[model samples]
Target: MLVPLYNHTVETPAAFFLVGIPGLQSSYLWLAISLSAMYTIALLGNTLIVTVIYLDSTLQEPMYCFLCVLAAVDLVMASSVVPKMVSIFSSGHSSISFNACFTQMYFVHTTTAVETGLLLAMAFDRYVAICKPLHYQRILTPQVMLGMIVAIVSRAFISMTPLSWMLTHLPFCGSNVVLHSYCEHMAVAKLACADSMPSSLYSLIASSIIVGSDVAFIAASYNLILKAVFGLSSKNARWKALSTCGSHVGVMALFYLPGLVSIYIAWLGQDMVPLHIQVLLADMYLIIPPTLNPIIYGLRTKQIRERIWGLLTCCLLDHFSQNS
Candidate 1:
């Protein structure tokens, strides 16, 4: 009786239920409004970034090219996961098909990996621009930049395929409810009846290779950048060089630190951390970076800020004209 019941349970859960927050049933309205605001901001900000970069031919440099890549990736990342999450929170319907869950997991992981790679590319661009100003153009030619984008996207897709395949094959004999709003690889894996050690190990290895190594390379690039900046004879030159990298560095820290912490707690201290805290951190790991990235990059870079100001002023003038 027990064996049959176990088999039936494992095979029966065709869909998984997603609970956005475990103890927040009474506050779904507030949560939905907050999440909707975040999602809207992320979408609008990234879209504006892409549009500004495209419209202003002066911003056609490699840095802006990579910025476009980052914005596009953030757009996809937010779109892939947030709408479903908002719907779940708003309507109180949490059921997601197993196949849909895996699809979401794949896009989330792939876009994240692509963002990590794009960050590394941006770091290298800065390194070349600052450290080897004479050779920057030759090093990051249009052809080369295109190749890097292709490689970054391809690598992300290939790396996640095996992990997603493994996840799809897992038999989820336990409860079909996922505790978080989105389908994280580890979150979903935890619900499987089979031993998920292999999946976890693979995830660790992939993350190390994609995220960890990119971080290491980014740090090295920044170190070289600092050394070069300090070597400049003029203080203004030094300040300008440092200022150029400030936004990228801030974005990197915002994205990686929370991510590392979330990964740590998810794997090691899942029981130690409170469920609410874990859920918040998990959501922030994805949402905060995309939401803040546009603001940080936009305000810090003069070209983007000027374009944004121009656009905003034009809109205001148009509104006033219509009202009058």
Candidate 2:
């Protein structure tokens, strides 16, 4: 039997210690505060988006239906990682049991994959609305929208299951310390005593293929949308069409840019990027998009904005009437 590091005789660690960020121990308090605020914003914003869409019958179109799915995904994605990360940052160190760690890893990756699918769906939604306006309703009926949602959720869970299973099979006779705040797949896989090359390569390839394919489809969608928009004879009509896509584009950039950076940096090895920087990028990639998505949509989408504003006005009026 091989002796383990850290004076352990077991082949696998019982729990993993999460260090919030390498070399940033002294800033844990500040980091915790910032992360907590972002998590709070993400929770409230996404919840509000879901509630608003649900309450307003007028907002039951395909686009708003897809927006509700995106908000739900954001809620799950942020919730899976942020609370534990906040705990780690606040305590300076946190230990998660092996099962719990793997569970978190599964949720994080699964939700991420689902969100990617949702973004692609939204892009397709836009493409149809812009390119096939006359047939938009016929093409994206309630039944079809439901089917798409089911497909997205099913594909995400199926694709991410193998990755989690592969990680759980690896021997962890070495260190039990995970160098990041959250239990990321690569970060946890690196702690295994066994040769983790297969896991790493699988992760890199799977992530690249999934993200790359979705991005290509989304790009192609926008390309056709822009072409159709520009082909409109009236400047106002072109502007109107492009404006509808602005929020989706902003949300996409916020999600994919930092995510791509984090993915590639992990693939390139920690030598090129500082470990702390990599961790921060990973954190921001998950946190920032959820925090800003609702805000972007609320500001850019007229119907959602009007519904939100109307709700606020009603609440304020009720409060004043009661007080007076």
Candidate 3:
């Protein structure tokens, strides 16, 4: 486990990561444990999605290709933040170095931006598939998919880089206790010993750019997709369209709604909740989406369901063959 590199005096977690305040009890530990379990499930879930997609030759279409990217982003997003959370909860020490905290903040939000872009791409892919099936191949070719990934990653980092730099430039004269599981933007900004007005402004702008723009594109793409899908007069065509859009819609709602809520909380100065509750709810940002996303895809997509069972069967047979 990676331990904190810097200390404020002694090495005990204060305020955010651990429930180590004067009156807190064992229930907090249980909550952390539950979150750890959730992270494990997220890891497995995203891994399974990646594995199935990579292994199945038939899943080489743009939809699954975008889903593979989504799964990979979820994998990183969950992994980048979770181990630190587990460590802080288990050891009751949440001290992180300035550089390390900035790095964490960058990667977590970077993955988030990547996720938003991929979701938009997915919405666009669905539009092509349903609205212009004949042109789908030309529209979303492999080279085009690669360009999309590069663009998503590049644009995300470009938009958020200033916010990452803002963390380092701010002076932390005294306060070091972050008010959440990991080094999130709001928590880290609140920890600044100096006034965080500049950092706060930068974060707001970056969020509006990366998160805000991605969401706008996603909503717009889906709006057009809705019109096209509904234009299909046949019931069977309607069902197919519904089925195709269901997973993307569910995943988008799962990710963005809570994220928007968190922005609200951060804006409201965490809204008078105990730091513990805030931390728990904040931790939900990492937990819920990754675990549920694969399940959402599996439930909505016949190919994914079949692929999962096929993988399960392959694993069982491999185990039996190895044993025999």
- Cα lDDT tens digits, model 2, 1-324, are 112233245457688999888999899889889989988999988898898999999999988999998899899989988888888878654998888888888888888888898889988998998899999999999999999999989988888877777777777887989988889878888887777788788888888888899999999999999999899999998888777677668778878887888888888888998999988888887898889888876546888988888888998999999999
What are the per-residue Cα lDDT tens digits for candidate 3 across 110-228? 88888888878887887787778899999999999999989999988887777776665655645566656677788777766567778787776677767777788878888888888
lDDT of 1 by residue, 1-324 (tens): 001123444455768899887877788888888878988999999998999999888998899999988999999988888888788879978888877888888888899999999989988998998889999888999999999999999999889888887777777776988988888778888988888888888988888778889999999999999998999999998888777677668778878877777777888857788886777777776887788878876556888989988988999999999999
What lDDT score belongs to each candidate, Candidate 1 first? 0.84, 0.85, 0.74
TM-score of each: 0.88, 0.90, 0.85
Pairs that collide in candidate 2 are: none
Best model number under TM-score: 2
What residue pairs are clashing in model 3? none
- What ranges in model 1 sit over 4 Å off? 1-10, 24-28, 240-244, 311-324
Off by over 4 Å in 2: 1-11, 243-247, 315-324
Which scores higher on TM-score, 1 or 3?
A: 1
Clashes of 1: 0
